[model samples]
Target chain A: MRAVEPEIVVVDYGAGNLRSVAKALERLGASPRVTSDPRALLRARGVVLPGVGSSGTAMAALEERRLVEPLRELMARGTPFFGVCLGMQLLFQTSEEDPRPCLGILPGRVRRLPGGLKVPHMGWNQVALLRPHPVFQDVPSGSEFYFVHSYYGEPADASLALGTTDYGVTFCSAVARGNLVATQFHPEKSGPTGLRLYENFLRLLVLEEARPLPWR
Target chain B: MLAKRIIPCLDVDAGRVVKGVRFLDHRDAGDPVELAAFYDREGADEVVFYDISASAQGRGIMRDVVARTAEQLFIPLAVGGGLRTVQDMRLMLKAGADKVSINTAAVQNPDLIGQGAAAFGRQCIVLGMDTLRVPGSSPPRWEVRTHTGRGGGRPTGLDAVEWAVRAVELGAGEIVVNSMDADGTQQGYDLDLLRAVSRAVSVPVVASGGAGDLEHLYQAIALGEADAVLAASIFHFRLYSIAQAKEYLAQRGVPVRRVPVPSGDR
Candidate 1:
């Protein structure tokens, strides 16, 4: 018996750490296609934008690969989308780290952590759940997730934030709006709790929706 | 608040995890991939794999070990030792390592740090500093010693604190200060050295080497002001489990990740 390949596309724009994300998906029995082609993204039952690095370079790479427009279109079409680390930052309008406009899919600004604190808020930190969401099912409200970034996103709409974490400031650590989901921490790198989040996202939003109706 | 990290470093040689006393006389610990999985399950905040192999052949095995470890292990994995170029760092990151630590190579070629940060964000690059105390200095200064174990130990003549600042300027996101004087002795971390570097750089400082008990781990974070503590022997020899170490720290009011023990484990 052959296993069907998962129609999940992990966006690759020359950023590092994509392999870890892909491997996590594979562990959950998904043969995720790591591609930068916008067409592949459009056809995916779910799209995962996983990135690490500065916004300047990440945005440049996305623009160069011709993925910006397609990503916007995918979100508009209500496809299940998940963003990790800088991928989540790019959804906002601007970043203080770099003087460039982001995808602007969501309204917000990415700003640096307050001075005197460690630049990269590296290590495990608790994510306090803002509301009940299926993506965080079984994962406790104060569960710690691995975070490695200097800048954090501040969405104009506070209600958009699904989870918040405190370093020097209490900021949005995870965001959800309809079909779009994103996290500042790397769930792929965050032990078993992290794997559960991925599983929940895949099962609830991606796989469950993709299942054919019983009548069909 | 960010939980203080407890990292268990695996000194790997020829694809096997081996621990050395003062970087001499190695003893086999176990297979790299299996030991890594064990640590991940036991609740290590992050795992570091320092490839101590002398040959290119041994380096080749690390990629496979890392790839396999990434498949099952869900924590951040850092690979160090012998990574000199941006391409080398890329090989590790592409092999599923979340971060790459550089020691000897970073000192020899400082630009390697900047180039790595430019290529793969500063967060991906870690500056591993091995320091030795000067015989007699009024202020107790230490110098950076590169290639510091087994046919290595070349002095760079740069002050440890000064060099840490320079590395951060050159784009190292985190600094791991390993005290050569205290490495295998496990007397305690070189508190003076760690405090100096931790205060000098705005980036997070990781205390490495010389952790004999849970108290040493506590001192590294409480007094030394280190963002994280990296120890090899204590956790490696099973004198204390990662959970026990975190519990000890938490008792003292140190914010440590208290990972809930999954049912049927331990």
Candidate 2:
């Protein structure tokens, strides 16, 4: 008999790189379902919201697919949620890239990287880990991760930031609060160190879910 | 600080990796998938696969190659060559390519850049320019060339610097300045063209063509002000490994991503 792999849902809302994110999860031996359906998201053992592009369009795509409220509800209930790139920015209250309100799950606005610097802060940059986190477990602090974006999330409360990276101006690169986690960089595209990040996130999800309740 | 990217470009024809000198005289390298994985293992920052084949059937084969390659590596894969429309961009991106580079088609349509960016976002669109220096032009100016499909380099009469700035305005996230005069010569990059475009655009500029040695790569960044350097012969011919080139740069105060050690080596 074959062992059943946990079903991880990758939210697909017409944003780019869904397959890349799904393939990375598949490489880690998990069965990833790429879907825009809210029901699929709710039933997922783990949910990854991977994105590229502008926050305004992404928010619109999520709204068009009716995934906005469900994603918000999932995060509110402490679901194991991982957001990447624009997915990380969409969790904010608003984005300067497009004049649209984001999910507002986190209390902050996404702002453009300061002027006089190249936009889309493309290529590899080091993420300075603020404190130990499970998802980044075994990943060294100040390690470089793949990033391609023009704007970054600025949380109203500073403690939500998990890591920060510098370009012209230092900005929050990763954030975690309770079961929710997100990275401004693309761990799925960051090679081995990135693959390890996925492994850590998946391992933590599986271990926590496999624990038997005291009542049982 | 962002690490300067060292990209190994694989010019793919049909299904195999091939290299051309000044967009002529094709030389077979190896399988695209294997070569990409090898580069990834060697700690290459990113790999670019340009589908040099012109036939429609060849395009289909490139898609398959992209799909197979995407399954193996976790790093970013950028696919270019003959991509014309937003649908074409969508097809390549769907096939697992992180970015789609538009060249000849972009020069003809121009709106395709904005359309692809609007449909898929600006980060997915890369503007590829084959530039040649206008002979005896005062202060040295470069003009754009396209139609590289059949080894034919057609002059577009557009200034390279002005076009780069315009393309960025049309929503291109990155620009690849491939100097036709310098390509395949392995002498060095056309620093003048690279610097002109780099200084004009607010987006990241990649210097391509004519990287003979480590010094050329360093010159592309330090002097040329290129955000990244794309080389083919130096890496494909095994003259210099990505690790060696990166080590050369890192030692000279240029920030580069440290090559991750293998598990056993650790």
Candidate 3:
């Protein structure tokens, strides 16, 4: 069966960097629609929750848009969801920066990186692939991805980690469990290497769409 | 495994690339678009365009320059100087700058950092601090300066290292600590200043100002632990090519991205 191009829904919770993320997706030939509507997110074949701000504000925005429950349901239904930076952190149970709790999709606490190594780990750093995953299909094992974050998600399950990076110590940079894929790094800002990853994501979207209806 | 970065800093004034002797004396460097393209081809990991002109005329010029440079350069471009509002940052990003750096504006309104980070992801915001070494101390204290190293009214009085840590906490993803004392010296990096800031922040620290040669670049990464090094005279004058600098660093056990040379050249 010929694969249908997947429509990408970029969750716009008022705090995410939607423009660049959408531009990157469009470059990969994926139809991207930046929307706050939970229905659009539910209907889309793939969801990209691209965030850039604080955990508290992000959570508030998601809750305000009423996307929290729908997103959880989408994840449970095996929708291909990719989160970047704060979007990735929001997948956890809670964050130290904000008092409010997170989605509790991933079991972990997002805490600040220890002092002396810098607060926001910015710029491009190398990603060491831990396990084979579709998102990193064509990407090399030690490919560099741009990262900018202060706190990182410490997922309770080690098996969920797909890649790890070292700043002061080895920390999870990308995570994958079943159909959910998220990266702490901003693949949109990571140049050609990053663009390639997005392209690979589009390919994954094609595969997900080609699967039998019952499985999908 | 952190990949080393090659960054080229363009001093923009009235929308033109300007180079100076001590960050005070100014001379036209080149068109930002042309220079950015040159650096991109020469294997620059990233490019920074510092708007040296804070005047109304300079702002207009910077907007045009940013648009032009962003069109040609595919790598990350960080634009700074005179960014005071969300609009200022928005203008630059819309004009093609991937990241926006704030120095004076950030000091004036500390919340601007968080606001900008929130508006444009933290990865797209940079805090550029102009630091000076205050004499007569065991560790030699570093202090933040503003207004092109001119009148900022008694400095911010914040410790440079501590301020960097706080800046990151406030949502600044990268820190560029430019040493006023080392500016235009072309001797070496202000190791003391670089080390203190690097030790304080976990994010990538870019050492700007006094880089004279390949050794200086190597020292900044090795001794100063800088993730990236920014220089003006060396690259602006064609004293060293980006590939040559990377080659020198690679020989010294410093990990750098290997740019494939042309087959004929090989």
- Best model per TM-score: 2
Displacement of the residue A78 alpha carbon in candidate 3, Å: 2.7
- Each model's TM-score for chain A is 0.94, 0.95, 0.95
Q: Model 3: share of native contacts present?
A: 0.41
Tens-place lDDT digits, model 2, residues B1-266? 89999999999999887763221124323789888888898999999999988799999999999999999887888999978888888889888899999998999999999999888878888999998899999899999998855463888999999999999999999999999889888899998888888999999999998999999999999989999999998887788889999999999999999998643354
By lDDT, the best candidate is 2
List the pairs of residues colliding in candidate 2. Answer: none
Residue A203's lDDT within candidate 3 is 78
**B46-154, model 3: which lDDT tens digit per residue?**
8888887858888988988887766445567889888889999998887878789999888889999999887877777889998878878676898898776454334
> In model 3, what lDDT does residue B28 have?
31
TM-score of each: 0.94, 0.95, 0.82
Candidates' C-alpha lDDT = 0.88, 0.89, 0.82
On lDDT, who's better, 1 or 3?
1
Model 2 vs. true fold: TM: 0.95
Candidate 2 scores an iRMS of: 1.2
Sort by DockQ, top down from the best: 2, 1, 3
Candidate 1 CAPRI classification by DockQ: medium
TM-score of each model's chain B: 0.94, 0.94, 0.91
Top DockQ: which candidate number? 2
RMSD (CA, Å), candidate 2 to true, equals 3.2
Candidate 1 lDDT, B1-266, residue by residue in tens: 89999999998887887763222124334777877777787899999999988888999898888888887788899999989899989888888888899988888899999999988889989999999999898699999998776643888899999999999999999999999999888899999999999999999999998999999999999999999999999987788988999999999999988775542342
